[model samples]
Target: MRVIVDHPGWTPASEPRRTVRTENSAWTATAGATLILNRVGEGRDQAPAVDTYSPMDLGGSIPENLRSALEEQGPVQRLRTADLWEALATAIIRQVIRADQARLMYHRFCDAHGAPLPEAGPSAFPRPETVLALDEDDFAGLGMAFKRRPLIAAAGAFIESGTKWAELPADVLVEEVQAVPRIGPWTAGATLADVTGDFSLYPYGDMAVRKWAAHASPDIDWPTDEGTFARWWRSFAATPEQLSALTVLTLALGGPRGQDQPPS
Candidate 1:
């Protein structure tokens, strides 16, 4: 099975799906699915394709007011990283930087130290242990700041704690991660959403979300409170995180198709 992931910054080896992309390029991991099989010690035996979520899956769950805005956009699909460490590390790298800059650095980091996926052409992002072992001088010219060292330390701590870190509940994960020197709500929330498929976590400090959510749903009254937002989502049996994605897609592509997710 061929896997192609287009989400920028997610490394290849850990990609849950077979596909992966860099800052500006997409690559097919021809043997990615096979690798998943190998990891689980399963022989190739005609496994079924994974069922993915689509906008149509939302159905009546969409709020009435924002439906039109979201309906006009291009294809949007929910994407997840291959693992918790990948999600957490990627979030840390993206903090307070322009996306293009961050993605370019991420590409460089992966290219230099990522593990070889011999069956596929591209390499996977280095594991937390590998990242922790890299010398500070090696990070030179990669556009990383001094703070990246501590970020790696935090990731190492999380990774070394074994299943304990992975098992952290959503709220607890947020609290624990935010305790890291430079990690914040936006980083932690984004990690939980990507790693755990927790769509209820809206990364609160994002400026784009603030602007888009306000513009797309004016009826709710902007800046009312978290409770108001929570209440709004409950009415549609949806989540602020989900609505945030919808709002972003609507703002970005004008609208999404009936069958595609918006801003996932």
Candidate 2:
């Protein structure tokens, strides 16, 4: 898939619709801001009805100065989550399944049951119970682990418990998702970015973060902790605009995306 950060764009190897790349951002266990980009209404005869939230201002938004700086560039168009639960699920599937088959299954699920919204209406996110209605083999057929069931089940619990979709604070979201079986930093941040627009959720802990960091400073002795790596990012991102620019810079110049993610 192609990610156009700003002026320069990178054609990420894996299809984002199916497989999500943790390295696409800057941190492995980012602040739970996983930006989900969809083709808008241009894909699979189905369109999502959810609003696209920016990663910079999820649940507990960023500081005003930082948020303004990030917003200076206008907006980064992303997918509507409510319309494509299968695609979102596909991101997890990508982690579990083989590369060649992820996109294929993505299409299969959408083609078979995806429901498009009205021209001006909101999109759809499948209910956890509805998703769990599927047999275990259904998820396994996608070449991923059986965690899909639990993941969906958890979403149901979250909804049933009256969890506000937009009220999860960054720290709370991180703690909540971390305890899940397949959720690591990357997955958690990715989810946050997509749903809440938490811009600070960098790295999302993908391989690209390490690669870009290495490329940026081949001479420095690498530090192993998240704290050390983030220090490097703060250097380039003193301002929010710099952080936005850094997302573009890291992708094209191989610099660090934030704390853990590298350039793709």
RMSD (Cα, Å) for all candidates, in order, is 7.5, 10.7
The TM-score between candidate 2 and the true structure equals 0.51
Off by over 4 Å in 2: 1-91, 94-105, 116-127, 161-163, 179-181, 216-227, 239-245, 252-264
Which one is best on lDDT?
A: 1
Q: Which 10-residue span in candidate 1 carries the lowest summed lDDT?
A: 255-264
- What is the Å distance of residue 2 in model 2 from its true position? 8.6
Which residue runs of candidate 1 sit more than 4 Å off their true CA positions?
1-6, 10-65, 211-264
Q: Write the per-residue lDDT of candidate 1 for residues 1-264, one digit (tens) a residue.
A: 222232345343454433343323333332233323222122333332221333443446654656655554433544446466767787777666655555567778787888655555446666778888877677765657564676677767766663687677877887787777677676777777666544456453245444555566677565545445445544553555555454335334322111121111
Winner by TM-score = 1
